[model samples]
Target: MATTPDDSSGQSTIDESASQVEILDADALADEPLPEDEAEPVDAVRPPGPSARQPAPLLPAMRPSSRPARSGDLLGYYLAEVRRYPLLDPEEEKELAIQYQDTGDPEAAQRLVTSNLRLVVKLAYQYHRQWANVLDLIQEGNVGLVEALSRYDPYRGIRFSSYAQYWIRAMILRFLMDNYRMVRLGSTRHGRKLFFQLQKERDHLIKQGIHPSTLALSKALNVPEQEVINVDQHLSAPAMSLDAPTSASGEGRPLNEVVGNDKAVNPEQDVARNELGEVFRAQLKTFETTLRDERERTIWHERLTASEPVSLTSLGKRYGVSKERIRQVEARMKRRLRDHLTRELGDEIPIYLEAPSD
Candidate 1:
């Protein structure tokens, strides 16, 4: 049976299946990552090999260029560029996804991603008020798109765009939270909730001629009064240069020195950290024993765990493949490492909020 892109009525112009992935409304975003796991120490261990400099992130840069003066102009340029890729119908999407899954075909994956670039832009628009430059949000969203490609399961019967939207939104939200203030906000889920809502709720109260106090906002939002005060203080606090002196006195110490100058080290914490490092290294060695393929084993040793990782492009040449293919392989290995750790450690694995970079 030949499938039509149109709905059952055959009257709808939009492909309902593709349209399903297109809906990423404000209410659908999640407040935070999973609950804290016991593996907090495990999370601290950088899974990939140590390097002089952090291996470049799998994602694109937060700010690509300083050239774009106004966000609107840059957006207009992107809108035009994204429009060049036509939307993929359901059949086309399924075909591409299945092909990519079977062979790790970069072309298939690229099509799936390019077709949905506009959707990423649409999702990024929802956070326009959160950040001044929409381009930055879109940049993060692109990371999510590539990430989604790495994890997307075509046979699961989920629409690609629908699944990709979650990644898109998550990347954007994380970017917003990270850059929200000079001192990063608390990692608590409640803090994330307050970060998004506290200001809006306060604005509503002010508009209604009611002063938004810690108590009133707490009662209205049903969060703790202290959390409300803490969030409000952070929001209201002005950014200051740490290089500046702590006080107006001419011979005063720098704020950084005065604020966090404690040189005391906790012996227990140091011991526990050392123990966790040993366990992490042990697990990596154990995983290495499980790799059967020559390429997989080489990548594991030379790139993933090497003190200085080989570049993906260089690895690609060694394997007679593209850097993108090398990346896909590296990502798969990391996923396996994560899975191996999860099975061995269960929920005890520490949860670090940031994406892992080797």
Candidate 2:
């Protein structure tokens, strides 16, 4: 059906639509409200630049210098102090000693004692070789030094070291006598004096190209003849080695009924049999070594025996790896044993035992 267009109404509708699209009324949009609270302002982000050059800060209460104090230097300082004081000076030492005796001036006494520490140390060195530990000797010597200082008499007309020698040696010998049960050495005063003097006398005799005779020693050191011989016996006895071969005859058994070829055959057989045993033993040892190195025996003992096998997953968890690694280790150990056997024997090596047929 053909219909004729209404030209006047069409032109009015088109014109109205164009006017509605073009014109947006500000009065209508003003009724719409905004959000309730205002948004916070964002910080301006700067681009990253070169790191700032700041010097490393010093530690709190740390020494500024790099050098450290040395032990030898400290020892030298102590030794120098000891060398200045000769154990005692009559007037000054007497005053210090009286302060200790009368008023109980422990501080004065400690000062006196500390100044003489190196003297104790020097004397201690003489006994160092006798004792197992230098520290033990030094400690004993210190005790001896203290006793000497306590019992010292100014009127004795003797040097401190000279008087202290008896006390020091007494303490050292007492310690040795108590400890060394192998032989009860130098317990008595006479024996103790002889112990030191005998050595010096013997050394002197040797230097003079004469044998160390008991009568000569008795005359020189004023000791009895029997004591010198006893000490000499202890020193001269040679120590025996515990590892020497045991045999009564001192050699091999004698052959009285020995013939020519038959007797020679026995020795040859012995050598061949021994060599064969050695070869097998060495191979067995090598096999055991390879098994141990691969940890095959250890794994069998730990896991497949009476002891329960730990979970592979648990082992993997501990090591931060997969359970497959644990399995691979077991497989590699097995492979290594077969490869080692093949290498040791030959490529065509046969199994000694095989499974029975059904």
Candidate 3:
């Protein structure tokens, strides 16, 4: 006797029985198609579904969105992402720095950079009031951070943050000096100090109920009074747009159009000055060579033509002559030069000599 399995729940369910045997004909089984779910055993390997079998997309179907275009929007995103990277403690920083320094491992360098991005952001924020584009400042500071990491000395007793702060602030300040205004701030050591600390010093003075004049600032900061005045003017001058309309008539005449081009070279004046200079130089050379007295020649070349003319007393001491003797020699030499120049170049000599005053 034979018993067939029952088909319930759309699947085959075998039943146990004693003394029951099931038989199948090979021709009948081969003629009928097996149901897909039924043909595969519970444990048998099966091909993936149609969705999975389809080709993968060329690009990710759900990639991370691009950063927004507006600065304000991007700033929020940057702050949130930067916060995700926790600051590194001294030990952690030292280890990563050492790893990078020894093996030049980029991954270790990356960890060091990511961990300290918050520090860059913090320093960049301090410069926020001074600059309009905070994001650009942060980007520059990040470059500084990378440089600091590359040059970091793990054996140094100082912490990485303290060391990195200098570079970070330096890069940001340099960027500001180069780009924050149409006119660049001076880069001399004293100029840089004044540029960076003038405002702070001024504020401190004001808080103390002291006037923040150039003299006061110069004394407080130990910078030259003129430098203090120059930096103060740079800080106070408002940025003017060249494209802005100049008048209420709405004629579209920009300030650039109305403003005189101070940089424009005066060809006429330049040519005249060049000709007069050549003439004066040739006549002066003749006069210098004609001088029979070596002392007079020395005084003429050393004292008169020097950019910072040496004092008469110094010249006299140098030549072991009295100051009165040196003055007389200089006067005679000047008269000879004036006469020679007048004879060679006529009225034009006075113009060139007088031009210096202007």
Candidate 4:
């Protein structure tokens, strides 16, 4: 015979299944209000949602691999692989340093160097202005990077990047000192500093007419007054004249030609050889009418005529007047005639003044 269900056991089994069914029904009712037993205690703020369902516990993050991986698919493989391994973990880097130091592991050293290529590229940019060529500076900086790697010490407690800075700077500075023509320009520290400062100062001076005084330069460069003066003198020195004319435009007149020479000529020979006799004779006939006195009139006509002129002293002797007085009379008559002729003849006639003879 089938055993009759034990009454208590059957009831307890039914109660457990019913409880599970209730839980399932409640889970299915997504929008149902929370049970009173599981609900948050009444307060000013209400719970955000159903209280029986606690949030799932968060899992800790997995550590990312330092090495980048090559991705593959069922069909094909891509050419490029992102190498996350190039990024150094501090601990892994420390180990690499020890291995390189103790065992001379070239691989470890290579890892360190490849990891820092970006850094070398960065530092090279600082000095590229003076060198102008990026490739040249990069090559120069690679030497610096190698020197930095050779000298990097893990024991000093300072970071490798910090230690490498000094070596990098030393290498770059050596390259600059050797290759830069500006270094030859200024050997002394003061001179070197002033070389750049003086350029700016000179530009400012030229544009605005401001003089670069010794005090101003000394203050600007933090150099001595004397050094400023010496540098300025060198800077301001006039360029040499290459001994060539600035242009081929005209004959270069000498200083002697710019100045003049004065000398006398023989008055008698000059008068006899003169060519303006016809114009003078016409003007003289017109001139005689101005002289009121007969003696003055005769003296004027004979003495003041251009050809065969007599001296003022000879004319004065004939007129019984001092030479100065006769000369004055002759000047008055010539002025009157010049005015008369200029008004009548429209100034086209050339009137030459007779020389006052002794």
Candidate with best lDDT: 1
Q: Count the backbone clashes (under 3 Å) in each candidate.
A: 5, 0, 0, 4
**What ranking of all candidate models by lDDT puts the best one first?**
1, 3, 4, 2
Query: Candidate 4, which ten residues in sequence have the lowest lDDT sum?
Result: 74-83
Name the 10 consecutive residues with the lowest summed lDDT in model 1: 39-48
**For candidate 3, lDDT tens digit of each residue in 1-358?**
0111132111222222211211122122223343334211111111222232121221111112244423434454444444444456778888887887788776676667666666666566555556644555666676566556655677744456655555566576666666533225444557556654666567668869999888999999997888777667655311211222322243323322222111222332332223223323434555667887888767655555542346778878888988888887877776776677555433210211210010
User: All candidates' lDDT scores?
Assistant: 0.53, 0.40, 0.50, 0.42
Per-residue C-alpha lDDT of model 4 across residues 1-358, encoded as one tens digit per residue: 0112233111111122222322122112222342334211111111222231121111000112223323312001100111111446667777877787677676777666544444444454455444443333444444555555565566544445444444444455445544543343345677555533565555445457767677866776677888777666543211111111111232222111111111122332232112122222333455556678886666554554323457788778876778898778877776776676554323211233433344
Error of 3 at 155 (Å): 0.8
lDDT of 2: 0.40
Question: Which lDDT value does model 3 have at 245?
Answer: 30
Estimate the TM-score of every prediction.
Answer: 0.41, 0.32, 0.40, 0.32
Query: After superposition, which runs of candidate 2 have C-alpha atoms over 4 Å from their true positions?
Result: 1-91, 155-162, 181-197, 200-210, 213-358
Q: After superposition, how far is residue 164 of candidate 4 from its true place, in Å?
A: 1.2
Clashes of 4: 4
Q: How do these models rank on TM-score, best leading?
A: 1, 3, 2, 4
Q: Candidate 2, which ten residues in sequence have the lowest lDDT sum?
A: 253-262
Task: List model 2 lDDT by residue over 20-63, tens digit each.
Answer: 32112212222224234532221111111111011111210111
